[model samples]
Target: MVRPVTPASAGFRARGALVAVAALVLLAGCSADGEADAGASASPSSSVSAAPSSRPDPDAPLDANQACAAMYVDGGKTLEERIGTALVGASDGLDGTSADQMHAMAMELGRLEPRVPEEFQGPLEKIRVPFLQLQEALDLADGGQVELDIASTVAGLKEYEKLC
Candidate 1:
């Protein structure tokens, strides 16, 4: 015996199909490594290669002009802007956005600390210390420590800016 499909049953089957498709789409984006694969049209650096190295000597000290250029090439300005914005926002209130920014900036600096020019790494590290403390203060709502750490971070940044 053959049973005719009713409109209601057809609609329910269509909805179930749509849900399965959506689930597959979402699962396709998930990765065990927690990193998404960039599209094929992404920037060149996103791909790995075995090209010869042309980077300058990491131990060599750069002149002010070179130092500034290197900083920009290494995304220093972007880091500073993000960290500064986080500091300012955290100063107003210790909210999730501010805290996330601070944590992200701190982790970024930790990764970049070793990559900076040898001469600037020390001062760069000094600035990172206060960033850590600022994150902690924000988490704890310790306004007094936050103010002091902010001052210290500003001072460290000024020193680093001189190298730039």
Candidate 2:
């Protein structure tokens, strides 16, 4: 006879499912041709460009307006758009690929932090923290922490949105 599921058993099953999904996401990132999908980085609201003008000044400090301009450079995905794209992969739940995307984005923002106005640094850190935690959870394979990380990410995003 089939037995009714207990809370502990249900939690175990959920964790197992999360692991399976993470594995699938990792595998799907690779193709038979050995090239990642180009569209993977494209956001609905922005396009990727390799032009020199599309790049931000790596060494120069920027005022708030300049920092916002750098952050929203045309032909490159805006921060909001990038986050949205990453979240699309996390619609059902957080997976390795999504976590990696967010972590990379956070790293990119960190690189820009030194060049940004002091007023913007705190909000940028707020955005980066949850993304970092999300990746950490994935790295540790802590399925239970993924939900909390995702929630934190969304909250952080909301706070950062008030800035630019």
Candidate 3:
């Protein structure tokens, strides 16, 4: 004959099953190299460095204004993030990664400059001076100068964003 389970015993069994499942899930995430495997991949839309080709063509006649705005908006967040990282990295210490990030941002801004609309050209141009200054500071490992340039770049970008 089978014995009747008490309420306490039933609750304990249910908790045991849950704990076992949790352990299996945790273990499944571990790789043989002792690194945890990435479980979920991000979609392209969630990526920061999305392709510029997906944006409208700057030279295209029909929608030049919209194209310019789209181009700027597309890369804005990623550039801002890199700039912030560079600033923080400088403040904390002249970390290699931080300087590298700032360099990358300068390159990206240079690439995007030609796409600026005539109407927005002045503001984008304003940004270049500080951007170059920031890069120079990074190269010389001048944290104080880097901090000042980062602030200037951020302010210019804010105005640029307002245009779009």
Candidate 4:
């Protein structure tokens, strides 16, 4: 017998979708050993060497390629890895620690926004926006919003894939 979807049922479906998406993103970011793939730097035009430190120089100007390299390669922990970690954590449960991690990653992206080339800003913002929204939804215990936030985050990650 076909059953009309109720609000409660819809919430459960959304939560399930969010969990599936989070798992996919996390798996995409890791390898068999569960470590981030070192060679998974985003740029395709040329090979960029890892920087001495994880962070780019705040004082120095960066081109789009250099900025992309700094974001994914220079850092021992790539931004992609961080995003995967945060999303998986949030999907596991809306705990205080997971919310804090999401906020931290969003802030990290915010700090890097100005340092990157002008072309990269929009894509970066796309990813950052959902991170913040998801954190807020978690704090508020909004299940529907949490699902929407996660979908937005996945979409944002797709946008970022084109940038690098």
RMSD after Cα superposition, model 3? 21.7
Q: What's the C-alpha lDDT at position 18 in model 1?
A: 28
Q: Name model 1 segments beyond 4 Å from true.
A: 1-77, 136-148
lDDT of 2 by residue, 1-164 (tens): 11111113232123333343334334332221122122222332253445635754568887654555554443355554565455444444444565567678778778877887777777667556545655565567644524323333444444443454
Looking at model 2, the pairs that clash are: none
Between candidates 2 and 4, the lDDT winner: 4
Flag regions of model 2 displaced more than 4 Å. Answer: 1-56, 147-164
Per-model clash counts, in order, read 0, 0, 0, 0
Backbone clash pairs for candidate 3 read none
How does model 4 score by TM-score?
0.60
lDDT of 1 by residue, 33-151 (tens): 12211321233453336355655476565444444443333343444555555555544445567568768878876765666677677767766764576556556763442332344
Q: How many backbone clashes does candidate 4 have?
A: 0
Estimate the lDDT of model 3.
0.42
Per-residue lDDT tens digits for candidate 3, residues 1-164, read: 11111112121122332233233323322221122111112223354476756764445542333323333323434344444444444344334564566566667667666665665555556555544665665456533423233334444555655554
TM-score ranking from best candidate downward: 4, 2, 1, 3
lDDT comparison, 1 vs 3, better candidate: 1
Top lDDT prediction, candidate number: 4
